[model samples]
Target: MKNILQVVHFPQGAVEDIRFIKSTNMPYAATGDLFISCNTSDIDANNGGYLIARLDKNFLNGIPTSLSWFNVVWAKGYAKAVHPWDVTNQGEVYYVSGESHGYDWSAMYCLNSQGKRRPVSNWRTHWLKNGTEWKGTPASANPFGQIDSVNYSGIVFKITGRCELRSWNMADFSSVQSDGNGGTRKGKWPADFLFNSPCDPQNPSANSPGYTGYSPEACCPVWGLAVLQLIEGIIMYTWE
Candidate 1:
């Protein structure tokens, strides 16, 4: 008889959810290793982290057994409060954080099987109101203030590797305006503008050159009715 029972228990001090490694070509996946993401009993203890372990296939009498070869991939404060993440067939873990902690806050990054930050030199294409263009590192881009979800798919060409990262989040940003004189006034835009066209962070004008009718209502609501208010859209970022 084949084992069909699944275990729903998390390792001690770990909570949230778990994802099984589905890498068909990786050694770890063949060994039945699983990926687990959790927050410790004390949120302040380890910040946020995940584990990789293997479940006993024996399932003695249908009772799930303890995990083996458990490896906790701690992210210190970098991946604080893990949100949504996915793993590749090559054993690479890609995740988006939930908290803010400097540059790496609310950003996406990867970790090798051994729990080390992998250098991502993939080509990133940005879709903006101005036009699609190549930009800097996508790891710390944090285009959206707080990322809510992330999905990754990897492809290997000979020795070179590439992947596509798709994510969505509630978009929010700050707005600045001149005080009429030589001074400037600053305010924040509501977090409901998800697909609004890009605007100059420092000096914003809704009717600017690249205005694609997708920009915020005249930079500030006081100027006109908010265009994309309370409207959320899926903005995917692909890294090849």
Candidate 2:
């Protein structure tokens, strides 16, 4: 014989509610239940962070028979808690975080069904620095060699762990050049040709000539708004 289960929906907040169903071959009654997770936001006033909720099976009309709650810390960037494929059998849960320690650093933690948490590993650091580029995005050029007028280079990072792993290069389309104007008009650009045109203080013929938009001494901030955007996208994709 076959069994059917029905699910009901209710409006709450940002997160949605979940329901479960089960069937058996023996002369036994199936059960229905719900699980929920709730918590405070870490990124915004109304969103993002960890949550804890409960699961009740074969709930009475007004009373719950079985209840259990679990906590999860939703991390920023490409980091989140994950369960093993056979989660029903695996009594442990794991969580991971993105490269927040450094250019390519990540962390992991484990929790048993009993809710005892422990560090799986220390913060794992991976240097994605390759010459002047970071994750394939042209960073600072070699001070010894004249920065390429038309070409650039950077480094990328590939991170992996038990719960999650990802490969991230510098923001796509980011470039570094000797002269911002595509290296046009010789000598009009930087004498060292080591900085992006917009950042080349020595560039005399700039896209906006006479305007000093370049900062030769300023090193690009490793963590910028662009980096945050990339990290957000990664986190969403990984968790979703």
Candidate 3:
């Protein structure tokens, strides 16, 4: 008789609701792992940061048996729309868009493939935005895709949403930005790690020059509206 597959139950945060879940493929593991995120109450309020957790991918259903799978607490607060993306050679890195730190304090964050959270103190390469909360499109899925214009597998965080699109070199995880100011870019549009973008990715109409229309690869045909606000996510981040 074939064993019936059972859905494994993972731990949850206090009064948190599951928003999104992704089957993550880790570097060290042969099989993919499970990644889940939850929102507090609703979109209007940012009272709760996105609660995130990761569970091992293993399923078995033969008779009634309790099993505890190894779970990793990925992020705590300000981790709405948790996404794990790879820039071809960039290795695997996760992007955490700040949804609500304290009243919708929107910002973007990055984490390496080793499941290691980069220190926030190094805001230069880790955090983006001029301490300005455009709250444009809160990145979900850590929701974004690769930039089509770039020759190498580059990233286009929010093709349409213009607070600022965050990209980095896979070789060194170096930050790249869309020169909203029209400054001459290097071979790869190399700019400051964390600075204001001339393109303004935090805004909805922020298409930038090299791109056209919303990112079909990122958000599957986003309607011309506040799409990011509709999605609920966990606020996983380091507390100050």
What are the clash counts of all predictions, listed in order? Answer: 0, 11, 27
In model 2, the runs with Cα more than 4 Å from the true position are 1-4, 8-11, 14-47, 50-67, 80-88, 97-106, 119-240
Model 2, span 65-159: residue lDDT tens: 43455555444443323211111123333334332323443333344455444322222221222322211112122333332321322111221
Error of 2 at 184 (Å): 45
* Candidate achieving the largest lDDT: 1
Compose the digit string of candidate 1's lDDT tens values, residues 28-56.
33333344455433343554455544344
Segments of candidate 3 deviating more than 4 angstroms: 1-4, 10-15, 26-30, 41-47, 60-93, 100-104, 113-115, 119-240
Choose 1 or 3, whichever is better by lDDT.
1
> What order do candidates take by TM-score, descending?
1, 3, 2
Considering every candidate listed, which one attains the maximal TM-score? 1
Model 2 is weakest, by summed lDDT over 10 consecutive residues, at 221-230
| Candidate 1: stretches off by over 4 Å | 1-12, 16-33, 39-41, 44-82, 100-104, 123-210, 215-240
Error of 1 at 51 (Å): 5.9
Residue 93, candidate 3: C-alpha displacement in angstroms = 5.0
